[model samples]
Target: MFFDRKELTNDQLVTFYRQILLPRMIEEKMLVLLRQGKISKWFSGIGQEAIAVGAALAMQEDEWLLPLHRNLGVFTSRKMPLHKLFLQWQGHPEGYSKGRERSFHFGSKAHHICGMISHLGPQLAIADGIALAHLLAGEEKASLVFTGEGGTSEGDFHEALNVAAVWNLPVIFVIENNGYGLSTPVEEQYRCSQLVDRAKGYGMEGVRIDGNNLLTVYDTIRGVREYCVREKKPYLIECMTFRMRGHEEASGTKYVPAQLFETWGRKDPVVLFENWLMSQAILDADGVERERQRIRATIEEELQLAGAAGPADFTFQDEIADVYAPASEITGEIPGSDRELRFIDAIKEALDEALQTHENLILMGQDIGAYGGAFKITDGLADKYGVARVRNTPLCESAILGAALGLSLEGYKAMVEMQFADFVSVGFNQIVNNLAKLHYRWGQSADVVVRLPTGAGVGAGPFHSQSNEAWFTHVPGLKVVYPSSPQDAKGLLLAAFADPNPVLFFEHKALYRSITGIVPDTAYQIPIGKARQVHQGNDISIITYGAGVHWALEFATAHMEIGLDIVDLRTLQPLDYDAIRQSVMRTGKVIVLHEDTLTGGFGGEIAAWIGEHCFEYLDAPVTRCAALDTPVPFNTTLETQFLPKARLREAIQRLVSY
Candidate 1:
């Protein structure tokens, strides 16, 4: 079928027809499966197939594709296996995501496709990161990101576009303005007359077109991709179309106006294309029928195979198994003999060594370049590596983390620093939802290390001083490490960079300058998931981490007559349960301590674990010592009183008496 033989060859025309037909057939089949309860949900690309297929066909094989949930045609156009799609919908083990995710929440590195998370706007920044990597490597490929009209309302969308424009990243943002976002119409979603007009604010080119016309969509995308590659700039295109079906199969079209559907039905893309093909004598009626039958047979076969596949063999342990780096992979030699070093100096040394060791390592944070970091941890790094490697970013925390995820996905390791751990709440979605679940959902490695300067003791108020390690410890896929000494700080930082997953490295603000110990100059990794017994005793065991380690040591020194064992847990998520059990079993009395608030601190988790597993071996109830359940005060006296030291001593005295 070739209506315009001069513009496109007969083969190209046939490919377009096949692309359109595949998604249409697949959409119909998915609806049938939904009715039969073979699939839990179905998102149709009925009237919107042209946008997805056209954009996919226009991009080069090396270019990346980040498609939204409704873009089924992108997968088909990328030559993704039909049976795998069925298996994914059926939640079978052999699927792309290995049955971990239910629907279109997976990506393929082999195919240059970035996966989509439920939070739509976050992917926009991630797409920018992919484009930034290509730009940095001198690659000609651009990244294509898809989103709906509703997603544009999110702050991430604006942040990504603005950064892409400022940096001139080669990214193409395609927004399918399908008239409605779920149930809300476009008029209610935005006050602007046209979404493309917003591009002027970011100093980027914007276009609006008829999304129903396959040829127009294909031409526009191809032109934009070439322009972006040549100019190293971002482009935005708003495709005007309608969602013929419901948001999902379960959400019917009752919310949509019947007259609007009736009006759009007359301009159906498939029907118009078929009529044009027949009019041009490129395809006869019999030829159209044959193509439809062939697609139907292919879908049926895949569906049957997918239906017969077994469920995934998943367990709770699998979700948390790979949180920390394996010990074998962390092996390395220490260069120089041990020398006394401050904790802050040790952290700086680790960064300096890591940057020199790994060529792909890049450092990113606010004021981290020539100005150094907020705490000078990354000072003089930009002077050594230049601004390209040690770059300073904006105040957008979410986009910064999202960009890190994108860079990690493209085979680069990123060492990102949050100015303070308290501000991490701004980027919580990217950390908890995107960074934590990437590997669990699709086996994607987010080799990113986030340095969170945490804890209180510095006269900084509620916004600057807060111990938030307990928040991350609760997440299954994150590796939480808080070091108490200079040696562990240096070693753990190195290990965290070597790890192939996201590691939340919590550096206590109070310990950074106040603590000093011998640290090796050479590269080395302290084994993760192992606790060190600083002192051994027969009376009671004190389990603690971060700055609490120093406090526990002080408490034990004063109470030598009571006899105490000090267990310093450097790693939190993949905790050293064996060490905890052995220490508690020997002492027969346990007390968990932390700097976080007492209500839901990590000490509760430690106490719960001990009570559940070591109840019979214990001589008394497990005691927890943590800060009072109140915001850290600005006054030094109140802050000291609010902490866990007095409470810890009281608990120790009570446990000894018991």
Candidate 2:
């Protein structure tokens, strides 16, 4: 419990004792409440309190912090209301909704707390990207990312660390090594005795500190953070702390060895600091009591406010309102689009027009510059706009998404591309957890567009041929748009670029060259969350989107006897419920199709929506045609069979006969 380190000042030690104890007591109370069933679940940062508070105190106001789930000390110190934290545990919508975020994922634009992410390790990569943004903006600030020892094992940790190291980014990577990762000890998880060594692999100096010693924790972080800011070089610090409680309140402590807890108990961070304070004669009995009383009062007041603040009133209707751009409210018809152009050209023209219109917009991705793009959509952009605006990034998907988020925060409209939609999984967390939730967390809007080449037909297999819209559609903050034809692609890309929040724009490779349609050269934007009726018939409502829309229309048109009403849902997130409901009401029959697997696909969501909202309109059970639940095979014949195609014709024939 005692510390041999002498780097910490007397004042810093006393401050740590005062700040950490209050949060620790509050955490203890919540843990009890969780056991009593009054609180839903609790993820307490108990034994690791000293390091958290110390590090948070060392951080500057402008520096960004991307916190993980176990960030009580960090949040509390940063003025997060404890009541809101409690409300979050109680599952009240207002809990996370009180701030820009809807849960324990607290952050503030004013505070420069980028936000907290529940995912294990991707936040580290985000921190790296934010740091990159700060350096590029020529700001005198850095970014700090805090994670546990287990998080170091994730691929994101490696990617972010390397990027930061290579670029000499203004970032500090702090590893809270609390011995066990959900009951698995450090010995089982890693081969090295110290986690700091892991940072060495990334070409950064890594330091090991006695985390339980408040003075050591504070001094180490404060020193390294300053070094990063001045030197613009990332550093890693391993905080050797321990967990006094279970991972979450729902997880029983029976799995953890009592002996391990006993071993760590001797080095209890709070007790160590209190004893050290007394030993240093920094404070007498009255001083310690006053500090405790002050913290307790602050926590009690916040908790009272949080308990009375009721749940969020926002509903699914709120989801429909914000899918498009905030500044440009171009709603009527597609602008200057009476004539037609190629989809690829439409995409290029849209980008060119958007860049000229908005000075904040930037295009970034691998080979998107002079090469135009992997698909030649961004060709001639670099020459016209300059290389700085149309950036060619390293072949790292996570970094690309992270960089996009950083740029978006700084009022830049960033359009990042994944060479293929299947490759988007590489940056999935940054897209889903961070970029999607930016507006939700800090209430700060991030205008980011992720353009991805999706679907199959050109001999690309599982890795290259994927319609991953379903993955993003399920996420709360993102808006997914899959355009069927070239015109729609142009309109949708422009709309996505203009959107205030994050947009995952999916472009089908099959339609890139094969299915040509007309698009105007002038500025144009397609309305998001609106489905166009491609064909109007009385028999059935075949709702589809993206490349699948073509198949749905072909099958419907081929069968003259069974007329169909085909609705193309251009935007997946803010689904065109009005169009869908109208079609279902008129036809009284429904069929949903997509290029993804049927299980947990977007079609299931559409079917469920129709079942809930238009059950009476149904003539028979709603049928869904989706790709089989297997990887896209390399063989052309197998790929054809795997996708949702003319099989819908057979379904329509059977339905008409019935």
* Tens digit of per-residue lDDT, candidate 2, span 403-499: 6777665566788888888988889888877777666554667678898899877779989998778888878778888888888888788887777
Q: State every prediction's TM-score relative to the real structure.
A: 0.96, 0.85
lDDT of every model, 2 decimals: 0.87, 0.78
- Which regions of candidate 2 are displaced past 4 Å? 1-16, 28-38, 81-104, 249-266, 297-329, 337-339, 383-389, 394-396, 406-412, 430-446, 536-542, 551-565, 584-593, 597-631, 637-658
Task: Encode model 1's per-residue lDDT on 1-658: one tens digit a residue.
Answer: 2233348865677678889889988988888888888789887889888899989999997788999888888899999889988888888768888777868888888888888988899999898888878877888989999999999999999988988898798999999999888899998999999999999999999999888888888889999999999999999999998999988778888999899888778767777777777777778899899989999999989877776776567676755553433335555555566689999999999999999988888888899999989999889999999887898988888988888888887788887899999999989999998898887777788888999999889888788889998888888678889889999999989888888888999999898889999898777888767788998898999999998899989977887797788899999977999999999988999989899999989999899999999998999999999998999889989888888975887898899889
Best by TM-score: 1
